[model samples]
Target: MLIKSVFIILLVGLFCQTSYAKDNCPTRKPVICYWASWAVYRPGQGAHKIENIDPSYCTHIIYTFAGIDMDGKLTSLDNHNDIVNGGYKKIVALKESNPCLKVMLAIGGWNEGSEKYSLLAETEESRKKFAEDVSRLMINYGFDGFDVDWEYPTQRGGIPADKENFVALLRALKERLKPRNRILSIAVSASVAVSKQAYDIEAICREIDFVSLMGYDMQATNATSIHSPLKLESSDPDDRETLDQIVYYYKSQGCPTQKIILGVPAYGRSFTLQNPQNNHVGAAVLGVGREGTFTREAGFLGYNEICDLKRTRSDWRNEYLERNAAVYGSINKLWVSYDDPKTIVAKAQYVLEENLGGMMIWSIDTDDFKGRCGQSAYPLLQAINKGLGNQLPSSFSHVDF
Candidate 1:
């Protein structure tokens, strides 16, 4: 109960400090960048301009690992060898180019899923082993820290006991890695219940350096009719990004205010439902993604795809609801939810207004700057930095067109 009381006190302090901040820096906001090494090094992908990344726009570069190939057993330390040697090379190069940029390793992706995590979290030895592997991996690589992105803690396919086990895992991680002083983070769902169930916010904040709120994917594919935007509209059902409410929940639970990172999707999803004409279609059979270039079960599209769609009348964009920004095209009947430079700007502004730790893109690769889409991720970052950062107007003059 005392822990609960302390949590309330922290919440009170959070509100008082945020709403009345005199400094320009958002005291409670997070500054972040999502970097997927594999995606970045694809043929004619992020590599063409990997060196062109602007560090001023972001404070941290989160490196994602897709795991080792099926050949030899992969040690946690060198599991993601391919991405590092090939794709992440450019990432490391960027760091060499910009000393201020910080890189952290993200484990387990949507495809990789969290099937094995339940087994890993079932016992103390497994949890410790996992943490050791993560710590060793970060040190072995040039990474600054680790972000545990186990999709679900208890719901869906996740293990039922992982709710409390997650906190225990983090506690062990904090104790072990404290000496090394590595950055610790977790990719948690936006759901209030899930966050509450998975980890102790206050305890996690104490151990991990920051918490990246995986804010995207709030939309559901359930049969019920729904109009969920990646960035929910103010009018949507209990879905608006109301700062006071969100912060209240976190602070009340003892989560630290300074280490919160808001997650935003750089790209959108085009959902192919059973009916094309129905605006209230449910579920995503396939993705008529950005620019109609690809379709998978809720697969992602790059910023380039969106840009191309804008020009080519991509089916995904053809029937998008102008008001809700929902995509409703394709004869198969599709509805998509994604973010562009414009929407990205709105969320970035929200970060500033709310004094959140800062924002992190779902991935750096999704932000295509080659004009594939109408806009690029770089400009979006620039907008965020300009909006929330201490950027001066004179700095823009030095940037090459």
Candidate 2:
């Protein structure tokens, strides 16, 4: 009788713990931060490693760009493909060093997402196959879950029926992963597009674990004005997406309040155009590169190079609040886009106001102030963490500064 009582108590305790973990204010809230290796990572290329990482601030690490398969499925090329290429081992090493950090592999990005997602969602078989493939991919590489970076759900001006299909696809992902506990999240834009496309926003919110909002692009690079305003009162005319606005969109659509995570960009965009008066009006890039193309292809500068310039060169200046930091100074007559510390403060406040899920940042290496060529990486990422209320998980608390 005594043993039975003890066992029952233990079971109750376990259940309580599980319930808490699922709560918005779980004793240990997970602040998921993403890192892109495919575009910027290379063996020994980064100056830092997992041990050097300040895990206290970031609870999850998402390795982006494993690429989608020929059949429109998400696949992992980290462990299977030339592992040494994209800091795959370094990422694995980060996980080993930080037990509290749950790692996931992200597939698809803005440019290469959801082309056939609608067609795949049409048939149940296709959805099941996609789920099975995702499970295999995660299990094979030892990841906790998958991050779906589908740029937009509905039409990309290419097709008109992706809205409903997007919801069906999430439902299928949830169904297939039911037996096995895994994470599923969708990357959503902060524009009015969600409402326009007829994306079952309420349904998408119901099926997925959390909604990740890309709220950084309110103002692009270049131009002349406040870009990503944080706390605007409408009548206040501050600028950017307000927390209340974000909450209204999700809540109106019936999305769970606590399950939404706001995204803040670790890197900023750059642009230069003729009339640099308005922030949004599409401008010409004065730098070597142009917008919409890869940095290398565009011929201006890549991430690491930019970082080096920020440090080694005094001429480099970032006008964070102006939304023209990357083009802070005109080399003659031109404009650019990017943020500095001033804007990050507002971004963090938005997270607090809505009581959203968490914050996820773009490619970590790009944020390194030193460009991996100088002293320890600084500034960029640390600023973001500081902005988010510094709600670091206990597991990473012991992490060094």
Candidate 3:
């Protein structure tokens, strides 16, 4: 009887431990999605409003972006009327549906450039003012936190002091937000050359909750190569361009695995083939391909547009490169390199294996919100959720580390 009781107690302890681990997994590994503010105005895409976002699909949604005024203050990038009357309130209202959802306001982006960020981070006074203004903006607009998307700190048109200044700025922001229990995150370059020169990663990581690694665009626009390949092909010149190399680079740089979020593109890079017959991986390209129906970018197509082409265009051929673990589509003289459900699943598995924080999509608005893709709306996002085990029976909440 004594031995049987001891065995029962051991079984109960193991069960409790398993349940606790399961419960903590989703909350600890966040699935952060970015929502671009400009998608509402794309000519043929129609307005993608904040109301359309399904809160359950993402653990956190970053609104891109709020700009920096000349005086180094945070201001809305969109029209004031639209921000006040439409986007701002509707975004905060999402919490009503999913109280676990965290909404963040991202400041600066590729076009915004780094000049203003360099200026703002140059001095203690400027950093303090910027932090205070950001804190106020979050409180006023009901944002849960802030995301700094400085294109490049020391590069671009920024000053040499940007590397140090950026760290100071993060510390200042953290000081203000910590009191309110708010979150702070920064988007950093995934390129080894750029990231090494532009950021003091260890110092910066200490001040923020997570590092949103811009893992896409490793390949140049003029080049005919896979933009976000998981592994380098034999023909590839730079192995650093691969996703595996980028993640390992950050990990080696002293970034805690839990504080690093791998970025996935919701769109693909397209290149016009010099010869339609030579539609292989490293074929030469004349220039950017035709504009997407919705995105309207010459060399870019959102997942929805890609899916539409696959469904309607007979010339469209989807192929997966086993060597790179990436998917690319070809149609006539155009080829697009993008992540499909298969690549997303592989990336999700990598995230779990490495114990990384979670996966982050560039912009949620580019997703197939209308279900026109035939695989259901937000299929890529759904893949990430499934990959991360977010659909498991467990409670998720705003977790800070």
Candidate 1 per-residue C-alpha lDDT over 204-243 given as tens digits, one digit per residue, 9 for 90 to 100 = 6776777877766655545312222433344456644333
Best lDDT among the predictions, by candidate number: 3
Q: Which of the two candidates, 2 or 3, achieves a greater TM-score against the reference?
A: 3
Off by over 4 Å in 2: 1-29, 40-54, 76-90, 220-227, 231-247, 273-334, 369-378, 391-401
Candidate 3 C-alpha lDDT tens digits along 272-391: 999988887778899988998778889888887888888888878887876566788898898999887778878888889989999999878887777787657788888888888776
Off by over 4 Å in 1: 1-30, 40-54, 66-90, 222-235, 238-248, 273-299, 314-335, 372-377, 390-401
Clashing pairs in 2: 221-337, 222-336, 222-337, 271-335, 271-337, 272-284, 272-335, 319-325, 320-340
Question: If scored against the real structure, what TM-score would every candidate get?
Answer: 0.72, 0.73, 0.89
Ranking by TM-score: 3, 2, 1
When summed lDDT is taken over every stretch of 10 residues in candidate 3, the lowest stretch is 392-401
- Return whichever of 1 and 2 wins on TM-score: 2
Residue 78 displacement (Å), model 3: 1.0
Per-residue lDDT of candidate 2, residues 294-386 (tens digit): 333332333454555565667554543332222232222333344444455555556666677766666554555343645545455555667
Q: Candidate 1, overall lDDT?
A: 0.58
The predicted structure with the larger TM-score, 1 or 3, is 3
